[model samples]
Every structure is written in structure tokens, then in C-alpha cells.
Target: MPRKAAQVSEADKHAAEGGAVAVDRALFLLRAFRLGDTALTLAELAQRSGLYKSTLLRLLASLEHARLVVRHADGRYGLGPEVARLHAVYAASFSLETAVMPVLRQLVQDTRESAAFHVEQGEHRLCLYRVDSPQPVRDHARAGDLLPRNRGAGGRVLRAFAGARGQLYDTIRREGVATLVGDRVPDIAGVSAPVFGPGGELRGALTLTCPASRYRPDFRTDVLRAARALTETLGGSFPFDD
Candidate 1:
């Protein structure tokens, strides 16, 4: 679950940063442009950034010189070509494993259980990446193994986000997670949460599994945290939060 953020102004945060206050404030101004905003007038920028026009103009001048922001003939500001170049470079260099492995490894360490990333493959779910528990006893699943979509916590998460309807699926949808004992295999329990990629797509499910007798309900938090971290890394947002 997401914790409530303490009320803090951007100016306050910039001040709290002992060094590079100007740089932080300039970045904050850039962030004032939201999705669907093509261009912002000086007054609009001021309204959004809560900064004085003098400060903004000076920052905007520096940003324009760096090709990070552009001013139109109408005196409106828009993101510049350099931003696209940076995005292209980032997108070209990104790797799925780089974004996912660390989260799964951390989840395993935190829960002391097996962790896996599962993706829907037609009528089945594929275990794309997995980290085994340190303990000797654990489920025998591995990376590249395909499991049924009709069973298991990971499959249920995929189905729930894919519009499956039922009481259990409804609960999973509401809670942003699914937990089941003996769902996929006898005496095996699992907790799973959905991970997303860019454009709000359901990328996969991050799951933790252990013997039913040893399963702890608190593992749900670990699963949720791992899922959220991976989702953010993939440039997707998880809407469920406290």
C-alpha cells in the first residue's frame, strides 16, 4: 500500500537540498509541463511552478540554450528536441532484466521465498524470470516454464487485469494482489501482484510462492513492493495506493 505523503512544497524541498538549489528549481519548472500539454505561456508556467517570472525567465533562458526547452514565436514554452534524443537513447539501451531482476532478488531476500515474473502466453503463463529461495525446500518451477492460466496466483493476476470476472477476481482487482493456498499445486501457496510497462500495459505478474504451511500473509506487502518497483522502472504507474 502507498503511504500518504507529508505536505511539502516544491520550494521547501528545493531549499532542503543544500546544494544545487537552482538546478533543482529548474528541473521542477520543466516538470510543470504535464501530459497533453503542448506549450505553456509564461503566466501558465508561473501558475504551475509557483516561481517568480524573473527566476523562470532566467532558468528558461539557460534551458533554451541547453536545448532542453524551446520558446515559440508566441512566447510559449515547450519541450525541445534534446529531450527526444535523450528518450531515444534511453529506450534503445533499456533491458527487461535490468529493470526486473533486482526487484525480484530483493523480494526473495525480503520474504525468504521463491520469486518469479510471469507473463500471459495465450492459454498459459510463462515464468520469464525467477529467483529461488535460499531454503532447501521450494517449488520446482523455473524460468521459461509455462504454467496454466486457469490456476495459480500469478495466473489469477493476469486474468483479473484482463477482465476476468468472479468474486475472487474481483477481490484481486480491488486489492491489487491475489493470494491463494493450494491453488496451482497441492500444499503450495502464493501471493502475486501485477507489474506494468509503458502505456499502462500489463507486462507481467511478480509472485512469491512457498509451502502452504510456511506461507505468511505479510508476504503480500513484499509482493506489492516488488511489483510497484518494477512497474515504475518500466515507466508504468500503479494506481492502487493507501
Candidate 2:
């Protein structure tokens, strides 16, 4: 069967790329209910999700049954109590300890390099969390280390998203990642991407560091994906290049 043609929202694009079309589309609907939205009608959902009314209704039925949505007497819908329950569950465990460590670990596992979360600290950057490479040869930075803010991939990301104007900053803001070689310490290279907070504010930079001899340009993709994951986990929207 041919898929119907319609305008695709960024969330919808994410859903399509995620491979599980039905589940992602259902999530696409839930996400359509934004802040200050108490309720949404069928047409509103259809308009936002880019799904036909029939498909939307089916998804809504499943969502309603799962207590993820509620149908009002006015034929409108609102999020159900389960969402609050889930939020409570998430809130109880949401922290850098629970949220960031796993991503850093996986990043190290993927690239066989070091991964760290860097935050802007006045004139410098703080390594808030780090996972070292399994390889014997690597940089020796650890968590809580204060690194330079004027150079390095992580610093560039912090400066770029914070609106530092220049060609280098422009590229980082546009691509949502920064890859640099020997910007700080000699023989060190890194790729970093911005992680956003709940209000879409720049929270920190997700960085992957390796010896210049082993740095791969492809590290940018891993860094960006890790940053995007962390952004969404922190309740921020991960905006993509359109």
C-alpha cells in the first residue's frame, strides 16, 4: 500500500527514521500536546500528527486503553493520569548519575575512546562526567577536571550555542556539533555537541576525546547522536538541521 502524502513535522521525521512507524506515530501524537495544551480535538491531532483521521483514531483508541490519553465528553482528548505517574517515576531517578553515565559508557564502547560531559564554568569548562577508553593509550582527564574554555571541541560547542559570533561558532551552531584536532592540548582531538535542557537552554557539551593519531571524522555523528539523546532525556527538544 502507498503511504499518503502530507507535510512531515520534525517529530514525524524522527518517527519514520526510528523504524517502528506505528509506535513512533503514536508518540508523535502524544508529543503534539505541547505545553499549556489542556486538550486537543481530533482535527487538531490530525493536523499536528499528519496522520489521517482513521489512523489517528486507531492510535488514540490504543492510547486511551493504555491510559496514556483520555477522551473528554466534548470529544477532545487530554493526557491521562498515567503520564503523571510516569513523570513521577522519571523524576525520582532523573539526574546526571542516572542519565549521563550510561551514555558516556556506551560512547566509549562504540568508539573505543573517552567520553565526557562538559559544562561551562565561568572562564573554563568542567568535566562533569567521564568514561575512559579501554585502550591503554589515552588522555588522563577525569571528572571535575577544569579544562580551557577558549579552545577544544567542547569549549567551541559551549561558545557556539551561547552565541559567540564568528565563522567557527557559526559552523558549530549550524551543524549542532564541533570537531577539532589539537585545539587545546597537542596530540589531542575531540568532537562535541550541545545538550539542551528542559527550556531549550544549552545545558552542556557531550564530548568524545581521543588521541589525534586515532581521531576519526566520523566521531561527529556519534557525538551528535549522544548529545541529541541526552537532550531529549533532559526534556529538551533536539532541533535538527532542516
Candidate 3:
């Protein structure tokens, strides 16, 4: 089943109790721009993020100053040059595996599970890179593993965060994070979050995979933290608390 957006938000809010709030709201504003339009008026930006006009203006000004957003002559705003530069930095920084290898390594080291990166191409999420677990008995996923968008944890996370469909997209539009348990494989549980490119397009996803038995009561929190850390390290952002 396509997991309901309301249920996802409720669960996420309950899990984000002790994380970075400012970073969350800032990323929320960025994600809000993905709502049907590539550019937005200040009023539209404020409305989408549920922030006061004054607050949204201030945030926009800050982003503009940092070159993460660019204001048009007509008072509309779109993604800025700095985002392009950041994207270039990202592209030039590493090969696919090298780009996310640190995070994958960390995930495997910490959870003793498998970790991978997947990108959306047409109707499928293609595994582009992966890091194996140190344990001899770890679950394995290789490069080029193509799964449907609704099949597994990585797919669900990418789908929810991408906000591709209409109303379903709007509901999770401001929260750029997602999780799934057994949606893909019955006995395998995993979590994933979106990775954006310079143009704010869905470039791919970062996922941590583990056996269902290893998913403790606090597994969601652990995954969320790992996702947030990876985002920060990559100079990427998400619309939810770390």
C-alpha cells in the first residue's frame, strides 16, 4: 500500500524530539518551492512554508544573500547561483561511490548492516552505489538494482520526499524525509531520504539497510539521525529535524 502521508508526518514528528530545528525549517522553506512551481512570490513562499510573511521574507533575504536563492525583478524567487556552485562541487567532489562512501561506511560500521545510494530514473529507483557490511552475513544489494518506486524502503523514501503525485505530494511536500520498514522485502527493514542536485531536482537517495530483527524500537530515530548527518556532510538539506 502507498503509506498515508498524515500517518508518516505524525510518526516523524514523534521521532524528531531532540534534533536541529533551525536546519529543519530552513530546509522546509527550500522544499516548499517544489510545490507546483519552480519560482514563487514572497507571499507564495510564506504560504507554502506556513511561516509569517515577515519571517519568510527574512529567510528569503538570508538565502538570497547566501546565494542559495535568487530574487527576480518581479519579486519572485528561484534557486540561485550558489546552488549551482554547490551542485558543481558535489559533482566534482566524488565518483558516485566516493560521494556517498563515507556515509555508507558509517552506516555499515554503526549498524553492522548494508548501505547504498539509489537514483530515480523513469519509474524505477536504480541502485548506483553501495557499501557492504563488515559482518560476513550482512544483507547485500548491488549497483544497478532497479526497484519500482513503491517497492521498498529506498523507493518509498524517494517517492515520499519527491512529492511527485498531486495531493499526496502536497501532504509530504514540506517534509523532505521518509522511512519504510517491510514494504520492499518482508524480512528486511531500511530507511532512506532524498538527495537533491543543483537545480533542486531529485538526484538520488541514501539508504541504510538492515535485517528486520535488528530494527529496535528506536530504529526510526537512529535512521533519521543518520540521514540528517549524511545530508549535512554532503552540504545537502532536508525539510525535517535531524
Give per-residue CA lDDT, model 3, range 99-175, as digits (tens).
Answer: 57777787777777788888787899888888876777656778777777877767876777665575534444455
Candidate 3 structure, TM-score to reference: 0.56
Q: Which regions of candidate 1 deviate over 4 angstroms? A: 1-8, 11-19
* Cα lDDT, model 3, residue 202: 61
Question: What's the CA error at residue 98 for candidate 1, in Å?
Answer: 1.2
Cα RMSD of predicted structure 1? 5.3
Instruction: Give the Cα-based TM-score of candidate 2 against the true structure.
Output: 0.78
Go through the candidates in order and give each one's C-alpha lDDT. Answer: 0.89, 0.89, 0.68
Model 2 score (lDDT): 0.89
What would the per-residue lDDT of candidate 1 be over residues 191-238, giving only the tens digit for each residue? Answer: 999998766889999999999988987898888988888998998888
lDDT of 3: 0.68
In candidate 2, where is summed lDDT lowest over 10 consecutive residues? Answer: 9-18
RMSD of 3: 10.8
